[model samples]
Target: MFTLDQTLARDCAVVGDLPLCRLLLMNDSQYPWLILVPRQDGLREICQLDDDQQAKLMNESNLVSHILLQEFGAEKLNVAALGNMVPQLHLHHIARYAGDPAWPKPVWGALPPKPYSADALEERLARLQRSLAAVGSPLSFPA
Candidate 1:
């Protein structure tokens, strides 16, 4: 059975599930970041996905990138699937702004992760859900 990596489970909010991937919201409040993890066990690279699965992952990732950019008025969308630490098949889509703390640099290790407050987390998740809904995504979010 598929399971989330311990670090991921501890650090992210379960936003929902698509047919083949679980949508996750990174808890860091600094940026609008989301992750998509394929619900397949022991897969640590995108190349491991079969052709159809690879296509689906890209499609989903693009959909998420566009939504985040619009919702956050991002100056750029940073999409990546680097699993150097966790070794899980997960894609990250981060919305970046020119004036953000990280600015021209990558978000990682720019500063310590600032977790969202309970109320803020809830609100951010709602906004993400609404964005997904607006795009007519079929994923089902937690109530």
Candidate 2:
């Protein structure tokens, strides 16, 4: 069965879920990012999904991409499912801009991840949860 890596489990906050994927918010304030993890256990590849589930995951990913673009004014959206380090099945959705801290470069390993201050974290989580709700996402997160 697929279980989240302990590091990821501790770092990400549950944001919401589509039919086939669970959405999570990465805790780093360095980037506005999300992770989508398919619910099917032990899935390690896109081909592991049945055709319908595959379609659902794609649809949900696209929907999230759109929201991040429109609401967050993201100049670019980086979508990836690389499992080199963390072997669990998860997709990353990172909102990027031309002037962001690591602009023109990938967010990964650009700099040390900055953990949010308590108040900052609370504010960001609330903003993100509200935005997701406005987009018809039914998920609410604890602060």
Candidate 3:
């Protein structure tokens, strides 16, 4: 019943899944960005989820944020749930550094996305998969 939006699927690589969300890694090599999309249909906002689902989403979001920060030594962790272009309830967790290209400003629309090359993408995915596997919680990596 849950299907990913075309734009999201095209732009991100499947990292894995949590109990309630599908984890995706944005292909852009600029920043370590992860997206958590709830596995539900016709859900366009976080408020649409019940209290329990909301709590689970929050937990998963925090886990991804912390992972990004700790693994990347990020100066800041930015989390947002914006569905302006794609009407799916997806939360973005981006690791930010003080000297990053989009420092002092949001990553969106600041500069063009520098997508990872084939080898780089595969390596990044493997690294993320390993990281997610170590979390050892509600987070589940696909076989």
Candidate 4:
């Protein structure tokens, strides 16, 4: 069976589940970010997904990027599936602005992760859930 890495589990809050991916809201409030983790067991690479699954992940990623851009007015959308740090098969969709912290650079190691305050976290989570719902894919944080 596949298990989420401890670091990922600790750093990200569950946002919702889709047909092919489990959407996670990273704790970092610096960027509007989401992580998509496929539910395949013991998989750690994109190639691990079957052809149909690959297509689903891609389509879902695109849909997510579109939502982030339209809702947040992002200057740039960064999507990546790097597993160097966390060896689980997951993709990151980040909304970046030209003037955001660590602009023109990768978000990794740019600054310490600033966790959301309770109120801020709740508000952001609600907004994201509502947005996802509008896209016909409502999600929920893990209780």
Candidate 5:
């Protein structure tokens, strides 16, 4: 069986499930961020995924990059799969801007997380769901 890392569950909102990943939106409202975790059991590294799985993940990553660039108009998109804190086969997709607080730097530890308020979180979730729908993929989101 597979379960999301507790740390991730605490820090992110359930966005939806893609073909092979569980999409999550980071709780922070400062910058646009998303995470994708393979829905596989006991996997901590991308190398653990077979070639086909790897390719699928890459395609999904590209989909997210496209959303950030086209829908949000992000200046730069940062994609990483650092499992230092939570050793899950998860990837991070962050949207960066020139004058943002952590410009030219990473989003981690640059500033404390500003969790989205109830209204903000709702709006964010709705916008992201719409974005995914616009992509025409049959993503299944939480009720």
Candidate 6:
């Protein structure tokens, strides 16, 4: 059985799921940030996954990075799997621009998160759902 960490659940909106990961959208409206959390229980590091699972995670991570660059036109994409606080095996994909507030620094603790407005959140979720669903195979979206 698997459950999302409380901190992650509280900070992100459910985007959908992939074959091996539960996709989440970080609620911060400041940038296009997404998270991929593997659905296995008690996993705290990427090395914990078998080779096949590791391959799948990379494929999904690439898919998200591609979309962020192609669709969102991110100048640079910051992808990381840091679990210092949550201790879950989750990858973060953040679309970055040179002029962003965090700029040359890590997004964390740089500035307070600006959550999306009701309509903005809805639209953003819909857009991401469409983008992910459009890429068929190895990807799944909840109805």
Question: By the TM-score metric, which is better: model 2 or model 4?
Answer: 4
lDDT of 2 by residue, 1-143 (tens): 44566767788877756667777878888788889888767777888888998898898889779878987898899999998878778899999988889989888889888887878777776777777777786563323
For model 2, what is the alpha-carbon lDDT of residue 36?
A: 88
lDDT of prediction 4: 0.87
Model 3 scores a C-alpha lDDT of: 0.89
Worst 10 residues of 6 by lDDT: 134-143
Clashing residue pairs in all predictions, respectively, total 0, 0, 0, 0, 0, 0
List ranges where model 4 is wrong by over 4 Å: 138-143
Off by over 4 Å in 3: 138-143
Tens digit of per-residue lDDT, candidate 6, span 1-143: 77989999999999888889999999998889999999998999999999999999999999999989988999999999999988988999999999899998999999999999989999998998888778774556655
User: Model 1 lDDT vs. the true structure?
Assistant: 0.90
Task: List ranges where model 5 is wrong by over 4 Å.
Answer: none
Q: Residue 97 of candidate 6: its Cα lDDT?
A: 94
Give candidate 2 misplaced runs (Cα > 4 Å).
138-143
Residue 15, model 2, lDDT: 73
Q: Write model 3 residue lDDT over 1-143, tens digit each, in one string.
A: 78999999999999878899999999899999999999998999999999999999999888888789878888899899888989898999999988899998999999899999999999998888777778775556655
Worst 10 residues of 2 by lDDT: 134-143
Off by over 4 Å in 6: 137-143
Query: What local distance difference test score does each model get?
Result: 0.90, 0.80, 0.89, 0.87, 0.91, 0.91
- Clashing residue pairs, backbone N/CA/C < 3 A, model 4: none
**Per-residue accuracy of model 1 over 16-125 as CA lDDT, tens digit each:** 98777999999999999999999999999999999999999989998888888788888899999999889989999999988888989999889888999999999998
- Per-residue C-alpha lDDT of model 4 across residues 40-132, encoded as one tens digit per residue: 767889998999999999988988898889988999998999999888899999999999999999999999999999898888878888888
